[model samples]
Each structure stands twice: as structure tokens, then as C-alpha cells.
Target: MHQAALLGGMIHDASHYGWKVAQPPHDWRKMAEAVQNHVKSLNWGHRVQLQDRKVKYFNFKASFVNPHMVCGVSKGGEETLLSADHIVIATGGRPRYPTHIEGALEYGITSDDIFWLKESPGKTLVVGASYVALECAGFLTGLGLDTTVMIRSVPLRAFDQQMASLVTEHMAVHGTRILRGCTPLRVERLSDGRLQVTWVDLASDKKDTGTFDTVLWAVGKP
Candidate 1:
């Protein structure tokens, strides 16, 4: 998805080198389908690799029955208890949603679903200050879309402040609107199916509203 946006800029830069090229319109659907297919291929490859190693893979929800035993339930209510010499549990965190906001969960999408979108997300409003948030906004802007980022406080808050400043500055110079010290209060669907976002300025305690085609949440995971 990131590469998809970079291609546009590369094409434009090529023109400066005396290359006769016209920037073609981006086809969001085509790019999304390609990305999705690539991910599916990777998944299939993983399963094949495990099979080659003579490993049994189960598509089930697993719970620890004991230190060496586990209970797994499949989609159709088939339950099985398997015991092994050792056990390992790997848990990856998931993105957090702002459920306190009236309509955030219902109207906003997380980074996980952004790349799988079927259509272009026009005039997008991205929420959060993590690298994921900045990177997503950056690519969306590079694709010639209207992009805005709403940061509750400083951007890249967990990273080095100086380097984070440089990144945010670069994004601002390249057409990404950065709303500092602000937070979204709610999201609503307008009559035209566009999203209406209401936010508040932390410093002034003032409320403002804007309309967008999509709202993306990139807040950290729990």
C-alpha cells in the first residue's frame, strides 16, 4: 500500500529527468486487490512450510488446559485436547479503538483494515500520533488525496522528540495537515454518506467540525 503511493511521486519526479510521462489516475481497487492476494499467498506459503516440516496446524481457538495440554475449539464446535512435550503461547496486541467517543467505533477503521479497503478513501481524517498514523497519512497525501491528522498531543510521543519533530515538519511541508493538541469527540454519517467529525482543541477548549470520506484510528494497542 505504501509503495502504491510512492509510485505516483516517482512518476512525477521522472518527468524532471526529461522523461515524457503523464501521471495516470490511481486505481485504488486494483491496488487493494493485488495487496490482498499477495497476503493470501503468504499465508498459504506459511501453511505449506509447516506441512513440509511435518508440523500439524490447527485452525482453532486454543486455551491452556494444563502446562502441556491445550483445549482447542473449532468453528463448528468440534473440541479437541492435545498434549505436547512443551508449550508456548504467543500473543500479539491489537489496535485500540476510542470507544468513549459516541460513534468512533462504528464510523472509524483501524490500520488493519486500511489496506483492504475496496474503494479510495477520499478526504481522510487520521487520528493518533504513532508512526502508523503519520505513515498512513503520508501515503494518503502522496496519492493526491486530501489528508488531515488529528493529534491529541505531540506526534510520535514515545519516540525521540527531535526526530519526531523532523518527521512531522516534513509531512506538514508535503501537504499533510497536522492538528496539534486536538482530539476527536465524535463521528457521524452525513446525508451524502460522508463522515462528519467533531473535535476539540485541548488548549482553547474550542470545538470544531469537518467532513471526510473516511476516519482512520491508529492509536496504540493495549
Candidate 2:
């Protein structure tokens, strides 16, 4: 659910029919608004819990909500029988940050967090060589910020060479500095809370240097 467009969001599986149902294209902002509205539509509804503090390593207890013991299966050695018309496990995959990079956890911002940003960053450094990384870099640069993309190898390494080169060129032409073949070493916060990025340029054999108000780690996603 990404790559949103101005009129309608990017369409996924639009050509597929029968086995593959097509979902109508939607505006990203409008989709977000709709989700918020749907959530608000529920009044007192089901039990909801808000945890202010981060989870401090706890095991979850399994309590069946359905009464009828139709679906008989004790996978985790559950003492109680579980039954329901249908079970839906919507626990989706979450993006993870690379542990090798220093200060990434501290200064790093992900796609989940970037949407809530009230003030656009003065400068943004995106770390990845993938499509998402490139798209984010372009978006930030279009918003009138000094955006830089640092990739361990050539930008868009996974795509066709010629097409990737074209996109890389276009990004640079649009004012998004592309730093390919650079591996981020650390992300240090200055006194002003800005990120001072350090890296190594594999191609040039020189110390890579970068600074930005925000550091977006777009290094691959699930």
C-alpha cells in the first residue's frame, strides 16, 4: 500500500482478474483519511487498549473470544478450545533497521514515522538503493529540501542498468544528491539535533561526508 499519486494512488494488480481481484486506485491522503474515519466510526465498540510505555518483554496470554469449539486445534498447547466463524490474523510485517549501522536507531526515521512529520526537514539523507529509497528522496527534494541518497552500491542496482542509470541521472538533475557505493558508518546528532552522517565511499576510497536534518534509512524492506 504505497507509491501514492496525486489523482489516484498507484494501482497494484490492476491487470489481474478472477484469481487476482483488482483494487481500485485511491489517493494516498484520501485513503489515510478514510482509515481514520472508519476507526472513529466505531463508538465505544470493542475493547481498546493504549500502551503509553514501550513493551518491556512480556508473553501474551491466549484467551479465545469465540464460544463454540468448532475449530479444534491446540497448536501452542492452549488449555482452552477455540471456535469462530473465521480467524483473521492481520499482524503484518514491520520494517526493520540494519543493526550494523551506528546511531541508526537514534537518528533513523522510517516510513511509519515520516508521515507524522509536521515540519519538513531542511535537509534529508535517504539510505538505500531501492525504489522506495529513491522515491522518498525524490519526494523530499520536490518539497524544496536538500535531499541526499546514500547507497552501498549504484542507485537502483536491482533494476535494469540503463533504466536505473536514467533514474539516477534524473534524481541528480532534480537536486537530490546521489552518493552511490557509500556505506554509512555512523549518524551522529549535532548540538542542533541535526544528523551528521559518516560513511565510506567504496568506489572513490574516500571518506564520505553528509549532514541532514533527517536521516531516512530506506535500506530494503520486507
Candidate 3:
């Protein structure tokens, strides 16, 4: 997704290198299909490597029955019990959603689903201050979409704060709108099929509303 965004800048730079080419239109569907297909190919490669290593693969939902025993349930509802000398749990975190906000889960998406979207999320509101949030906003802006970021506090909170400011400033100078010290209160679907986001300004305690084609939450992950 980020690479897709950089293609535009590269086109602009082409003139400096004597490649006088016109700025071409971006095809979201084509880029999305290519990315998805590449990801699927990588997954297939991993499966093949595992198979060649003589590893038994089970596509199942597993639950620990005891310290050494596990119960696995398949998609078709078949269950099996397996015992091993050792058990290793390796679950990864996923993007978190603010379920308390009205219509959040129903109307909004996250970093996980944005790239997978078949259609472009026209005008977007990205909520949160993490690097993930900024990266998404930057790419969307680079793709020539109307993108705004609603930040509750400092962006890149865990990283170097001074550098974070520079990163955000660069984005702002390049055309991304940054809404600081604000948090979303609710998300509602509008009559025209757009999303209406209501947010509050932390400093003024004032509420405001804006409509967008998509709302993305990048708050954090558990």
C-alpha cells in the first residue's frame, strides 16, 4: 500500500531525470488485486515449505484441554484431540476497535481491512496517533485521496517525540490534514451512504461533525 503511494512521487520526479511522462491515473482495483495476489502467493510458498519439511498442518480452531492436550475443531465441526510433550502458544495481536463508540464496528474499518477493500475508501477519517495511523493517512493522501487524521494526543507516542513532529509536519506540508487533540465520539451512516463522524475537541470541549466515505481506527492492538 505504501509503495502504491510512492509511485505518484516517482512519476513527478521523472521529469528531473529527462523522462517526460504525463502523470497517469491510478487504478485502485488493479493495485489492490496485485497486492492481494502477491500476499496469497507468499502464503502458498509458506505452506509448500512446511509440506516439504514434513510438517502436519491442521486448519482448525484449537483449545487447550489440559497442559499437554489440545482439542481442535475444524470448519466442518469435526473435533480431534491431540497430545504432545510440549505446547507452544503463538498468537499475534490484531488491530483494536473502539466498540463503545456508536456504529463504530458496523461502519468503520481498521488497518487490517483498509488494504483489502475492493473499492477505494473515497474521503477517509483515520482515528488515532500511532505510526500505523500516520502511515495509512500519508499513503491515502499520496494516492490523491482526501484524507484526514483525527489524533487524540501525540502521534508516534512510543517513539521519539521530536522526530514524530517532523514526520507529521512533512505530511501536513505535503497535504494531509491533521486534527490534533480530538477524539471521536460517534460514527453514523449518512443518507448518501457516507459516514458521519462526531468528535470532541479536548481543549475546547466542543463537538463537531464531519462526513467521510470511510472511518479507520488505528488506536492500538491488544
What TM-score would every model get versus the actual structure?
Answer: 0.93, 0.62, 0.94
Range of the 10 consecutive residues with the lowest summed lDDT in candidate 2: 1-10
Q: Which ten contiguous residues of candidate 3 have the minimum total lDDT?
A: 4-13
Candidate 1 wrong stretches, greater than 4 Å? 66-68
* TM-score leader: 3
lDDT of 3 by residue, 32-139 (tens): 999899999999999999999999888889999999999999999999998999999887789989999988999999999987999999999999999899999999
Q: After superposition on all CA atoms, how large is the RMSD of candidate 1?
A: 1.7
Q: In candidate 2, what are the lDDT values of residues 152-187, reduced to their tens digit?
A: 867677679899999989879868898777898898
Selected candidate, larger lDDT, 1 vs 2: 1
Judging by lDDT, tell me the better candidate of 2 and 3.
Answer: 3
Instruction: Provide backbone clash counts, one per model.
Output: 0, 0, 0
Question: Looking at candidate 2, what is the lDDT of residue 18?
Answer: 35
Of the two candidates 2 and 3, the one with more favorable TM-score, higher being better, is 3
lDDT values for all models: 0.93, 0.68, 0.93
